[model samples]
Target: MQANIRHQVSPYLVFFLIYNSQVGVGILSFQRTIAAKAGYDAWIGVLAAGCIVQVFIWVMYKLLGKANGDIIDVHTNIFGNVLGKFISFFIMIYYWLASVSVLIAFIEIIQVWMFPTMPSWILSTLILFSVYYCVSGGFRVIVGMSFLSFIFPQILIIVLFIFPLKIAHFSNLLPIMNHSFMDMADSIKSSIYSIAGTEALLMYYPFIRDPKASKKFAHLGVLFTTFLYTISTIVSFTFFSENQLKTTIWPELSLTKTVTLSFLERFEYLYISMYLIIICALIALFLWCSSRGLKKIFNRKQKYTLLLLCLLSVILCHFNGSFKDMLNKYIIQMNLWIFYCYIPILLLVLSFIKRGKQNDE
Candidate 1:
């Protein structure tokens, strides 16, 4: 049966999914990682890395769009038959495993920060069900949910600035760039870390209504998300001291704790709830893309493909050592490799062959 490629998503909706997916739980932890390397200068690394990511996004879009297909299709066309299928299989595994690791990390964060007493199985079940629900509806619905979640969570972030009005310690951001250029470059790595979801644009390209607008939408999404990351990091640092910031795991939550209103006490709870929605969308979207990759590689039906992959991912999530251990050992390291080494080389090979074929033509 032919795949259902209807219900095209708008540029705005695409932007929302890309931004929200990239901004997932990483923002909460990244400040410390970046800060540790560059100190107060980490924000600079983030902005610089944001610019570099835009270039990577452009290269990705051009290469993937040349195939007018998903990553699997792109790989197959460039590599051909056996070698192509083998490569596609590796790509599919990489994508699915990455999604599982992120989902597991989200559950672990919720357990530690939001609900210490909650069972891990229960949390994982809820997340899996939510992801399945979104995945079943397809990419357009998933993107719509992303737009909704982005607005509310961002509004809460805007409200958070009010806390910095009184509690902010501007001195914490001093000694700027005290670290060497290499150190700043090192700091920027974490920013690039969370920027994973923008690669979704490749799988998502087929769903865009106006193909001409695809590249513009993706770049704008990157810019907007980078702005959000910078502002949020700046505000978080302003509100907490260097010593306090270093000690804190999730400084964004710490930034929210200063918020007090007549109705609510702990704002982080609301933040966590909204955040889970974005995280769920990210996992669902990634899983959907990975399923698409599998279908292209094996030539299978989408429905059956997704079902099988989802089951496999659910099992993988459960069997993990722990989300943190998985991230530290495998996920974080592997993700960088996927983007920087795997993707770039793949694109370069495609570009060279495509040009050679054009010359022959």
Candidate 2:
């Protein structure tokens, strides 16, 4: 299922997609989650996880390049249509649930910080409206939103970290390896959800012009975000004490409290407001991938698939609570197993099958 030439985007744009996809709600609160056990040493685990992601990027290209299409193409080629679409459906479900997880996470932030009495459905519907618009324009528009996300709010957000550094205790990161190896593993495990969006590439491979040339850019994108998150982790760790971070729900957002000026007050309100662009772009990318994958598997129009997905996302967001937790738990486990563990093995099996076919021919 090669995308039409007009539907395709420049290979370099993949960097923006990969970067924006991974930069979702996790960054605001991940510092506390990773530090839950590893304490200050968790930043090291982030670096290690970045290295592993780079390796995973290599594995994805090897597999997708061989298939010359998205994951659905590879599945049908190897598993036959009936069994393949069945498996692909589950992957699409994961992508859909992933978008919902990100959606509710931001809604929770807005309700807590800005509008305590606002209903979840109102915010969720407003967000999905933007997501539907971008996704309806096709993959290129989604990628463009990603590009804007990096340029606008992302740059400004990165600059905001400087204010926190003025009061940072760099010495807090001392004795980095003080924790046991198992503790480091726990930190890495927690960071996985924050850094997990790279796997969205599985569905969009065919939409990139000259995907081979795009591979380096994808790795670079991951590298940049990894560095970004690591720095964020260090900033959060340095700004707050170990015990304080544990109690803090959104450490990075709280860091905005330090930014004060005579002209303005309660910077976190402004901070959360600016974050709307970033959140919308991330949700658009994930929903695009999910809808596209389901469209291919079901042989349906993408608009119908996308609309169905948007409606489901709103419904799921409205029912937030234990459901959000359950959704995230499933997504993280599927991400780890489906991409990290299964993809490399799939590459090996694909290589063998291609070899056998060549011999028979």
Candidate 3:
């Protein structure tokens, strides 16, 4: 069901939702992954990935405009009711897995970097519990949380990068095109997952007041995210040698170690603690999208679906570290296919069907 007037968010809030959702755990280690493929030209890959995501955003808007509803309605409109529900079920599963991936990935970061002795299950339970609380409040609460999440970490985190510039070697980015075109193309493909998550717009599009007016704000959000990622990639490239950059798992976090203050011995500890807000926003958004999809398909209450998905995520988080890694890898691959391939084809099919109906009329 479409959100009522009281529940609908202002179009401008789309800026925060799109931006915050795209900047989660992936950005932390993306430098290493992209650098391994394109060397110092990884920033270019980031820019290219942003452009690609923008095109997908446009396509999604067009499709939603035609359906005049969310993805569940689109499926049911184009396919018969039985097949559409079947397809919608798989989409819900994908959203559920995406939420679980974000949850477990953040827990792993806390275990390794923040508190080595903290058990995964304990943190998982706590995080999912918070997700349950926020999501049960409804769409408006989730939008408020997304807005806070974007504002809190962005300025402080970007400011920390200034310290790294003291040691930066701008020359590292020289011979920028040394890598083959194919190499850069590979890097862009790798960067897709880091840029993934904007697809949540499909689920939430119907909840925006004056959904058409939200387009520019949504584009602005993507542009802002792209700029942030490009700058971070450039800083990471210049701050570390090519070999050093390739070896470092979380280059952005490592860059923080270069900062020092009179009272704080390790600034990254504070940074990581503050970063939990960003991670919480991410988990909450994905969980909300999944539960919303469930509610739409089953015509059930969203709170019940929210409780079910949150508990399911907590259970899955208890698996071994290796299983978590494999799951993350699979989720990224699925995202690449779903956004790049499936959305485009679905758009084409919907357009043709609409055209045929018009001709018949």
lDDT of each: 0.77, 0.89, 0.87
lDDT of 2 by residue, 1-361 (tens): 6799999999999999999889989999999999996989999999998999999999999999999999988888889998988988998888888888999999999999999999999999998998899899988888888998888876557657999999889999997699999999989988877898998889889999999999999999999999999999998988999999989999989888888768788878877887888889888888888888888887899999999999988888878788888888888899989988988988998999999999999
Clashing pairs in 1: none
Among these predictions, the greatest TM-score belongs to 2
The model with the greater lDDT, 2 or 3, is 2
Residue by residue across 1-361, what tens digits does model 3's lDDT show? 4668888999999999998789898888999999999999889999999999999889999999899888888899899787897898887888889888888777877887889999878999888888788888888888888898888897777778799999889999998788999999989988888988998998998899988899999999999999989999999999999889768888898988898888898888888888888888888888888888888778899889888887778789889668888998889788888778998899999999999999999
RMSD to native for every prediction? 2.3, 1.1, 1.2
Least lDDT summed over 10 consecutive residues: which range in candidate 1? Answer: 1-10
Candidate 3 ranges with C-alpha deviation above 4 Å = none
Per-residue lDDT value at 284 in model 2: 88
Candidate 3 — what's its lDDT? 0.87
Clash statistics: count for each candidate = 0, 0, 0
Backbone clashes in candidate 1 total: 0
Of the two candidates 1 and 3, the one with more favorable lDDT, higher being better, is 3
